[model samples]
Target chain A: DAGITQSPRYKITETGRQVTLMCHQTWSHSYMFWYRQDLGHGLRLIYYSAAADITDKGEVPDGYVVSRSKTENFPLTLESATRSQTSVYFCASSENRLQETQYFGPGTRLLVL
Target chain B: LAKTTQPISMDSYEGQEVNITCSHNNIATNDYITWYQQFPSQGPRFIIQGYKTKVTNEVASLFIPADRKSSTLSLPRVSLSDTAVYYCLVAPPAGYGGSQGNLIFGKGTKLSVKP
Candidate 1:
C-alpha cells in the first residue's frame, strides 16, 4: 500500500524477550521517527533517523533501539522488553525539517507481560 | 526547545467554535507553532501551523500574537468527530543534525465535543 504502514498491529510478549516492530514508508522521506504513546498522554519520540544509517535518540530512548538500513524502513527493536515498555508505537515520516508536517502510521500496540 | 503548557481538557457543543490555547514563554526567535489532533487509537494528524499573526487552513486556524509567546488553535463548528486530543508544539529552527529535543509533546488538551 501507499503511505506509511506498521507491522504487528497488536503484540504480546513476556518480559526480557526480544521484540521488533517494523515501519515502512513508500514516500522515501529523509526523516523517519518512532514515538511511543502511553494511555492518557501525548506521543514521546523514542528515536529519529535523518537518513539511511543515521539515527539519533529522542526524548525516551533508554530501552529502545532503532536502525535505518534503508530509506524505506525504520525498525525499532526492544532487546529486553520490560513491563514499562508496553505502549502504542507510532512511526512518522517527513520530507524536510521539524517545521514540516509529519505523516504517521497506524501504530503498533505491544504488550509485555 | 521551548516548553509548552496548555489546558488538560475542554468541553464544547456541536456547532460551537472551540479554541485551545498554548503558552510558550521561552520560545526562540526561530521557532514555529504547530498543532496536531489525534483520534482514539490513531496517530496524530496535523491541523495547522503559524509563526505570527494568523494562519487558516481547511481543518483549523492558528493564531499567533505579535509577541509569539503563545498560540491558539481554533476549530470552527466542531462536531462529535472533532472530539480528540489537541497537541501544541513549538518547532525549532534547525532539523536533522540539530538537537534531538527540538520537539516535545506534553499531555495535550483533550477537547470533548458533545451533541
Candidate 2:
C-alpha cells in the first residue's frame, strides 16, 4: 500500500505518562503535518515539518513535541499526557505544489485517563 | 491565518444536489481554497480546490466568486455514501524551506444524506 500510515491507531495512557505517535508516508512528500481533532475545535495543527530536521510550530503546539529525522517519518510525543490531550490525531503529507493538497493518514485516537 | 466559517450541519435526501457555502472574509490574494471530505472514524480526503470562478472534478464542484471572500461546494446527486463532514480551508501560498503557512480547518459542515 502506497499511502500514509500511523502506528498505535488506538492508545490509552495515564495522566502523567509519556506517549508517542508515529507517522510514516511512502510518497516521500516534503511536507508533513500533525493535527489534533477535538469535538468543537476541529483540526488544529500541532506541528509540521518541511523536510528532515526542519520542524515548525502550528496553531496548538504546546504540550506536544515533534521530530522528523527522516523524510518518511514524523513522530509526535506527549511529554506528560493529560486528560485534556485526549483526541484523534491525524498525520498528513503533501507536496510543495501550488495546490498543496494534503493526504491524511487513518488517525490515532488517544485517550488519557 | 485566514479563518473560514461554514454551516454546522445540513441535511439532504438521495439524488439531490447539495451546496455548502463557506465564508472566508480574510482570504488573501495568493491563498487557495480547498475542500476535504471526512467520514466518521477516518481522515479527511481532498475533494476539490479552486482559486476563483468555478472548478469541477468528478467528485464535486467548487465555486469561488470574484470577490473570493466565499466559496461553495456542490455535490451532485448525493447518495448515502456522500454523508460526511466537509471542511473548507484557506491555505496561504506554499512556503519555502522552513516557513510554516496556515491551513486552518474549522468545524466543518456535516452533510447528512438520507434515502
Tell me what fraction of the real C-alpha contacts between chains A and B each candidate also makes: 0.67, 0.58
Which ten-residue region of model 1 chain A has the weakest summed lDDT?
A: A94-103
Summarize candidate 2's per-residue lDDT along A1-113 as a digit string, tens digits: 89999999999999999999999999999989999999887888888888899888878899999999999999999999999999999999998652489999999999999
Q: How do the residues A1-113 of candidate 1 rate in per-residue lDDT, one tens digit apiece?
A: 79999998999999999999999999989888999998666788899988999988888899999999999999999999999998999999988676778899999999999
User: Candidate 2 DockQ score?
Assistant: 0.62
Instruction: Show model 1 residue runs off by greater than 4 Å.
Output: none
Weakest lDDT window of 10 consecutive positions for candidate 2 chain B: B93-102
Interface RMSD of 1: 1.6
lDDT of 2 by residue, B1-115 (tens): 6788999999999999999999999888898999999999999999999999999999899999999999999999999999999998888766644335477786899999999
Per-prediction DockQ, in order?
0.69, 0.62
- For all candidates, the clash counts are 0, 0
lDDT of 1 at A33: 91
Highest lDDT: which candidate? Answer: 2
**Candidate 1 chain B: worst-modelled 10 consecutive residues by lDDT:** B93-102
Candidate 2 TM-score, true structure as reference: 0.96
- lDDT over C-alpha atoms for residue A95 of model 1: 82
